[model samples]
Target: MAKGYWITFYRSISDPGALAAYAKLAGPAITANGGRFLARGTAAKAYEQGIAQRATVTEFDSLEQAIAAHESAAYQEALKALGSACERDVRIVEGLG
Candidate 1:
């Protein structure tokens, strides 16, 4: 089954340079693991009040593939560089059967 990963980030972005650096590092890792970016930085027009500054959704061939991607060494390095610069909410879900 396909797997989906959703990530929401609320970041003030103290450093755009750092964000770009991290993106460069992580983007390739995901692609290498057979992941595809579905939506990124998509604005949500309707909500009660609080909302994430950015929302991203990605799909992988399988749940194991998704998990493996996140657990990969390259991604972990990129995630580490991200530090506490942003608050992130991430979830991995199996697609409908």
Candidate 2:
């Protein structure tokens, strides 16, 4: 099966402290569910209409595992901690075999 990836792009972060807290909790939760952080940081550059944003990419063994991680209680706690700290987009995509 193709691997799965959780892709997140933060358009804006209003609360640094909240974001920090979320990161602390979310990172571990993700790893606990067999997710690996491939990238986490600001974009190197933006081209055309692309908007520069903080982005994170996490890989998982499969789509089911990725979905499970997102639905887990630990990640839900992280989401609670995050609240409205940022405006972002999150997606789970299957990788090429």
**How do the predictions measure up, each by TM-score?**
0.82, 0.96
Cα lDDT tens digits, model 1, 1-97, are 6665645555455766666777888889888887899888746753776564766687888888888989999999888777766666778778876
TM-score for candidate 1: 0.82
* Candidate 2: segments with Cα more than 4 A from true spot: none
lDDT of the candidates, in the order given: 0.75, 0.95
**Lowest-lDDT window of 10 residues in candidate 1?**
4-13
Judged by whole-model lDDT over C-alpha atoms, candidate 2 comes out at: 0.95
Q: Compared with the true structure, what per-residue lDDT tens digits does model 2 show for residues 1-97? A: 9999999988899999999999999999999999999998998997886568899999999998999999999999999999999999999999999
- Top lDDT prediction, candidate number: 2
Inter-residue clash pairs, candidate 1: none
Model 1 clashing-pair count: 0
